[model samples]
Target: MNSNLTVMKSFFLLGFPGLSPKYYRPVSALLFFFYLAIAVGNIFILTFVVCEKSLQKPTYLLFCHLALNDLTFGTLTLPKIISKYWFGDGFISFHGCFTQMFVVHYLGSVTSFMLLAMALDRFIAICFPLRYPVLVTNNTITVLCGFAWFIPLPLMLTIVLHTLTLPFCKSNVIAQCYCDHISITSQACGENINIVLVTALCIAMLCLLVPLAFILFSYIFICVVILKMSNATGRMRTFSTCTSQIFITCLFYLPRCFVYVSNTVGFSFSLDVRILIVLLYSLLPAAVNPIIYCFRTQYIKQHLIKKIKTSRFGIQLNLSFL
Candidate 1:
């Protein structure tokens, strides 16, 4: 350990270093906009699915799970960072930091598995159309989603527990918008820091790569099946159904993989640039997912339009009566 090492009871998040005080309100306003979009979009999806009995199928249920996960993630990380910029409060206790780290990682792992589950659902529907109804029921989807949320708990807990045992004597200044395993572990003071980094990297890659591999395979099979279709119109429609999911999958995985690979290859980004990349990859997908579903999914679009028209007609009727 270095001679300058000192115990750190709390961590300070230095969000966007060198940001002038004048920019604080502007930055907070921008982040609040993103959080609002994420909350409203996801909450709308959740509510719409619950209220629309026609959409209580396996596919929409899976969408609801994804929405719920995104909502939880945005709610978990964004509020504090928003408050920090808005109120000039950025200190976080040791345990609180680790707790945030755990949840961040756990939610990421859940999302990876959730994407895999969705891919599986699509794979079944596209490739085995006859068996899809029997094989991919609501109960089956519930089980898959439940497992996705549950399996990550123990693995992420192990990582967080191991990190908590390491002495954080180097510094408490986290150079990111929020606490994460890499950012937190980078502040540890010990000779075993490299080991911890490698372990964390391996675990993260395992969580990411495993589900990604499955998703890729599933999509490949779906594509092959689509190519074999006899009717061109059916082929185009089936392919269109998958475009939204493919877009979302790419959105979620590509940036994350780039960041991980860049870090592994020793490519360095400045603190502010790195945090911006993290925020974009982490939060952008959540904000955009509802929009994508609303526009791309035929059932959702139809139902949403109908609901809006009905509400408008009801208001018109009330005005006429008055």
Candidate 2:
């Protein structure tokens, strides 16, 4: 542990500023319900993808990685927030805060990379259908998946290492429900941290925005290919395949970009609203990701429907015995 960080002892989270006292209990309940939904939804995606041989393709495998990443991120940040709001337990140890920050950002970057890989898979599958089998073989995809999961760790480790070294003897209140690089970096004052901050910002952009740009280009080329196809049904089918991913991309990226940009440009926002927007983008996707995949992707949908029916039949059969 870095000595500077060890001095923090613990950091307090502000929860949602300006929230009414009367609403705390209700809000805590809502957050707990949200957490449960996220757990169940993502668990369904991860378990079904692994168990069902029909969904063992590259795309579904990517979705499994995504689900696992979401599960990790949500488990790290959400339950802690729930505890903070529900019981006024806002203090997190210095080591704990750093760990949370590392995991949250690490998984965020990995998910972006994983999404990029999935986009590439779609691009090959649709634009070069004949070549897709040759080009995007299972072994090729396995390597790409490995890259997605592993690349972010070392790439972002420098920034996290920089963060862990900064002095933090001042007040320990974090103005949000969790620690992120931005949230924690904003706390360092009195020390000459401007250079460190800028370097970290640059690293964050390189990791996040670069992948986003590639995804955009991949989709743009995909659109051009889809537009040239003569068969409307085939075109629609191809486009539909990308739709869920596109929707998820927008949900995951747009708000994060807005938040980061607004913060960078000194765009004034109330603390409460800023945090609210962050949570919407950060956590909402995990909750909705499985739902979107199951409902949008045909293979997963059919298998999910089958599983539901079988379970329902089992319940009825046991009821008859009773």
Cα TM-score of candidate 2: 0.93
The CA lDDT at 121 in model 1 is 90
Q: For model 2, how does the per-residue alpha-carbon lDDT over 1-322 read when each residue is reduced to its tens digit?
A: 4366666788888889899978888988998998898899999888888888878887888888888889888899988888877888888988788888888888888888888998899988887889988898768878998998898898678777887778886678888889888788777754557877888778778878899999999999999999999999999988999888887888788888887788789998898998888887889999999888988887788888899999999999999999
Distance (Å) between predicted and true CA of 246, model 1?
1.1
Candidate 2: misplaced stretches above 4 Å?
Answer: 1-6, 264-266, 310-322
Cα lDDT listed for each candidate:
0.91, 0.85
TM-score of each: 0.96, 0.93
Clashing pairs in 2: none
Candidate 2 has its poorest 10 consecutive residues by lDDT at 1-10
